[model samples]
Target: TQLLEQSPQFLSIQEGENLTVYCNSSSVFSSLQWYRQEPGEGPVLLVTVVTGGEVKKLKRLTFQFGDARKDSSLHITAAQPGDTGLYLCAGRDTGGFKTIFGAGTRLFVKA
Candidate 1:
């Protein structure tokens, strides 16, 4: 079994501050996905990276996949209060249908 570990399990910062969260794993994955979940809601898909070294941006958020497809990172620029939530990273196994998820990073942005 593979595991995904995320760093800085919790974070609190003033609004407009920039932050980066990391997700890492020892196993290589075919694809990786990032999601965000607010209180009382399921996680919402933010982005999916299929190719190694691929980078995607959504507004003030940026997502990147490691060159070896074994890790990923999420960077938020000028993070706002609305960005407060739980950030999750999931990776699909290269030769199986199983997907492993990280422990998750909880972010709180104070206004």
Candidate 2:
């Protein structure tokens, strides 16, 4: 079965910090998606990198896909209290419409 596992299930940092989260799996994926969720709201798509070795950035956040398409990472620079939220990584199987999500990384940026 294809699965995505995320590291650092929880994170707490003072405002203006930096951190990196990892997502890994033994199974290859056709596409991978990253999301950020705030309390009581559905996750919002942060970015999606399809090709192996692909990299994308949004503001202070950077995302990278493994060359083998089996892993990914997210890096945040100067994280603020507003950046505090749940980070999720999801992988889509090539053969179907199913998407599997990682356990998630919960971040807390103290003011």
Give the poorly placed runs of model 1, Cα more than 4 Å off. none
Off by over 4 Å in 2: none
lDDT of 1 by residue, 1-111 (tens): 899999889999999999999999999999999999999999999999999999999999999999999999999999999999999999999995998789899999999
Tens-place lDDT digits, model 2, residues 12-52: 99988899999999998898999999999999999998999
lDDT of each: 0.96, 0.95
Q: What is the C-alpha RMSD of each candidate to the true structure, in Å?
A: 0.7, 0.8
Candidate with top TM-score is 1
